[model samples]
Target: MLIKMNNIHKSFGTNSVLKGVNIEIQDGEVHALMGENGAGKSTLMNILTGLHKRNDGTILIDGKETYFKDPKEAEKYGITFIHQELNIWPEMTVLENLFIGKEITSSFGILNTRKMKALAREQFDKLSVNIPLDQEAGRCSVGQQQMIEIAKALMTDAKVIIMDEPTAALTEREIQKLFLVIDSLKKQGVSIVYISHRMEEIFEICDRITVMRDGITVDTKNIPETNFDDVVKKMVGRALTDRFPARNPNPRETVLKVRNLTQKGVFHDVNFSVKSGEIVGVSGLMGAGRTEIMRTLFGMDSIDSGDIFINGEKRTIKNPHEAIKLGIGFITEDRKDEGLILDFSLRQNIALPSLKSFSPKGYMNRKDEQDFVDMLIKRLTIKTQSSETNAKDLSGGNQQKVVIAKWIGISPKVLILDEPTRGVDVGAKREIYQLMNELTDRGVAIIMVSSELPEILGMSDRILVVHEGTISGELPKNEATQEKIMTLATGGQ
Candidate 1:
């Protein structure tokens, strides 16, 4: 084994997140760490990468017991981690970000700019990545930034690499490129710990699979010995009868329409309509303008040209406030930045968007707000100790539910959900799907943008594939397939 972790135990306050988890990864093998959203996958990775201290465990690196004091120490021992969230400095150039701490220096200790650029270029070429070496990392697309992060790990000559949801934002083509890189790494005898919720990806690339549920290790099996259904059953401890709720039989009349929508460099000439009681899915690769289109619709972005029709009447939406007042709600993809107020209690966050409903005169009504939040909490089945619990203290899945509850409390006519189930567990995903169905049944039109093809295929009444800032193709639910959507999303003619 390249690395062996035995009896790993960790806890946070009263929560036991990891309990005696044991896993072994071999060199040159892609080992997948499978689990639900809060099932200790991230906790185990954090422990291995030295981000958190394990209460009790034996971590053996290269057949010897070893402890990592910090991430730097783990890096020095040929281990690197690519976090689920982008960790690059947006203001710095790609090359600078890649070699941020481990800079090349001359004998006199001066910065070796020439050598660094050349080395970065070499790494980019070797990995088949096309990101500009000198371009600011912030300006790059999410997919490009992900590739840069992978290249940074390569630059460190890491023998063991841990990737957490690496393909979450990548396009089909980008994912293929990433697979090629992984193939190369495996050939060179690097141990890979792949953590992803996408079952297809785990089956396609992993040599071995390990499943975790509720902070415990359930089983580890060779990829060929287990299938997707087995893994899913282990992760959630129950067979999923239906991944998506039944589609609406009677979709209401068109409630929102976008005609000739244009956002210059972002998206151009986009046209779509949403009918009440319908879920319209927008599917695309990273940087394909899916989120941008949603942002434009939500008034979070300024449109260069377009006419929005509400209830068969044309109107202008200048900002989010205008959109909200027009009965539109948005659940952002970046929940941390756009969805929740971490410092606020769950009740406060849920009541924020709908404060007007609870306000008495010019003053806020705390009692009314609390009542409204209490209703939402019960409706959404949010797993929290109390309404006073800080939004930041909730798990990834619960935090996401809070975000949905916040928007659902507003009771908008149109709802836009960007990656509604991005980091959520399978069980939570099912709950969200059910919630969407319930909303549609109540005559709410939903526009959903998701990178997961399974979700798009399962939930969408109509699927629109975006490519290069344009709607490449549109398919009805019956005709939409993974292969077909991917073809159009890659600019296939």
Candidate 2:
């Protein structure tokens, strides 16, 4: 199938999201939709898939004007969208989720469980996913859940598939497997609209690229004809210097220390320490207990046995409130679920952690709260029309900025960042890195749990590799290499 979008315009309450974006997807090719956060890439896809109506545009499929009434209609027309957010039903079984609306039924309207299972199994096998169909979807790890979404889309037998940040939660091995599947799909004459912030993956897998900036199409080029520098320049409309900001560490006393931290069956004796102004990077394969360890430290989960020390004083933290009171902050990995309340305004979310300060007299001072929120929005460069804007209205990168701004308001001594740059664009990622540098300069100790090896190597003063819920190896910034980190992460001696 060949897809074409011309002069597409989209808006929400006078906010112009897409202002004349144009792109064409060829049959049997992997086309990349590249842009900075809030650049209208996802909105364009939403228009094409019938999630949102384009105010002014023309979409052609097979050289004929086509507009799907809804996403289901698009799916039925052999177009499938695997969104950036995994749409797994937590309470439903994996099998049920795979065939939620499109279930198999018998002649008498009875459910055909046997055939559904067989089809689901076949799709999972094609993706090399090992998840059990009967298991609760919520119990699976983020990476496993991502695989389930991929399998669900594949089962649609889609001629055109739109994948947005599909490999964000996947491990190296899983990424390789996904690439293999993409190659196989290409051979079968399927078209893939790949959307990702990871430039490496785009250059490796995509055939052609279309970049957008400020809701307008900037340029489109073949993968062989373009370079990383060129694409980033077009997306941000500026030249980006270094990928990571310089971190000149001046370590003070240890601000946070963990000794023999255990979360029962979840993680084993995990021990690490972070000095003031130090970035202690926690690197490992997905589901290797990195985020679990951080969650326990931030009092999100109960610790079966562990010793936590803040500024040389041992403390018992039973919940997030207690952790916050003790000068600790956590930016969770699952931003949609844990980081921000989608319905809340930006001011409300940013002022949540600092409510005590804003309400010292049992009443919030509106001016003070607004000023604080404004300062953070400007500092983080969060692109929003106003502080009263709903958190869900902003793009993914802006939502992440809001999450960071919420924690930064509390002025915590130790901050735990889980996948700080997970789905963020390159420019926003650099800004975040620069902010990390500024925070450390203020003597804030950071424990960053990241699955991206390059990020760990780029920003860390010290790196700790976790293998099987244990600290397999620790290396200083100078001595760390990608191969060494991967080796230790895989339980190497």
Candidate 3:
């Protein structure tokens, strides 16, 4: 074995995060760490990487007992951790960012830029990455940033690398590229700990699986020994016979229409319509103008030439307030930043959009606000100490539920969900799927933008594939396959 952690225990305040969790990794294998958001996965990894002090545990590397005092010590022992959030200086160039803390220097203490950049280029080329080293790191796309981060790890000559949600922001092609990189690393006998919510990638990449629940290691299985359904059952302690809820069998009249929607450089000739009780999924790679089109429809951005018809009425929506008045709600991609006020209480966030309903005649009605919040909390199954609890205190799943509850209270005619299930656990994803089913059943037209092919294929009544600021193709659920969507997204006929 390359690494081993036994009887790991950790606690913060009075809450115990890990309870005797155990994990082991062999050389040259991609080991998957599976768990819910708060199921102690991060805590255990933090302890191993020396970010947090474990209450009790034993760590062994190369058949020798060892203790890592800090991240530097862990790195000294040939271990590296790549955080889910890309840790890079936006202002620095790619080569400069890679050698941030540990820069090559001459005997006179001057930077050895020539040697460092040559080494960086070698690492990038090994991963088949082609970005210029002199370019600003932040100017590159998310996938490019991730590849650079991995190359930076290789720059350290790390024997073991831990990647947390590396593909969260990557497109299908980018993900395939990353898998190739991983394969190359495995050939070099590097051990990788892969953590992510996407199940397909886990099955495809990992050699073995270790499931964690609450604070303990539930089971570990080889890739061929266990299946997706069994893994989901072990992780969530329940059986999900179907990941997605039943799709709307019949869609009614068209509730919204976009006729030749064009936003100059952003998107051109984008035309799509959503009918009541229908889920119209927008599928494309990042920068495909999906998000821009959604923002334009939601009145966040202006359209150069187009007409929007809502409920058979041609209306010019100048802003979100106008869109809201016209019964439209948009749940943005970054829920923490765009959807909810982190410092505010759940009740406050839920009542923010429709506060006027409770504050009739210039007087605030406290009872009405309380009653509304109470109803939503119970109805949406938002787990919290109380409605008065701060939004930041909830888990990723709960926080997302709060975002959905806030919009559900408004009950818009058109609900636009941009990457609705991003950063959420499988259980929460299922819950959100159920909520979408309920909304469509109540005649709410939905427009969902997703990068996950399975999500689009599972939940959508029809899919709109975008390619470089244009709608390349539209696919029905029956005809939509991952390969077909990828081909269309890449501008195939």
Model 2 spans > 4 angstroms off = none
TM-score of 2: 0.98
Give the distance in Å from residue 91's predicted Cα in candidate 2 to where it truly belongs.
1.1
Q: Please give, for residues 1-493, the per-residue lDDT of candidate 3 as tens digits.
A: 3788999998776777789998999999999998876787767877888988989989888889887889889987888998765677888999888999989999999999999989998887777778899999867755578788878887888888898877776678778878988898899999999988899999999999999998899998898999999999999999988888777546999999988999998899988899999999999987788888988888988999989999888989889989988889998766655689999999999989899888778999999999999999998777666798899866665777888888888889999998787767787788889989989999999999988988999999999999999999999889989999999999998
> What is the full ranking by TM-score, best candidate first?
2, 1, 3
lDDT of 2 by residue, 91-200 (tens): 99999999999989999999999999999999888887888899999888888889999998988889999999999888777898899999999999999999999998
Q: Counting only residues 3 or more apart in sequence or on different chains, how many pairs clash (N, Cα, C under 3 Å) in candidate 3?
A: 0
Whole-model Cα lDDT of every candidate shown, in order: 0.87, 0.92, 0.86
Better TM-score candidate (2, 3)? 2
Question: How does each model score on TM-score?
Answer: 0.93, 0.98, 0.88
What lDDT tens digits, residue by residue, belong to model 1 across residues 1-493?
3799999999887778898999999989999998877788988988988999999989997889888889999999888999877687989999889999999999999999999989888888876677778899988866678788988888888888999888876766678778888988999999899998777888899999999998889999999999867888999898887777777646889999999899998899998899999999998878778888888888888999989999999998889999999999999977775799989999989988898887759888888888889988888777777899999877666788999999999899999999888667667788899999999999999999988888999999999889989999999999888999989989995
Give the TM-score comparing model 3 with the true structure, all chains together: 0.88
How many clashes (backbone N, Cα, C below 3 Å) per candidate?
Answer: 0, 0, 0
Q: What root-mean-square deviation over C-alphas does model 3 reach?
A: 3.1
Best by lDDT: 2
- Those runs of model 1 whose alpha carbons end farther than 4 Å from true positions after fitting are 126-128, 374-383
Give the total clashing residue pairs for model 2.
0
**Model 3 steric clash pairs:** none
Q: Clash pairs of candidate 1?
A: none
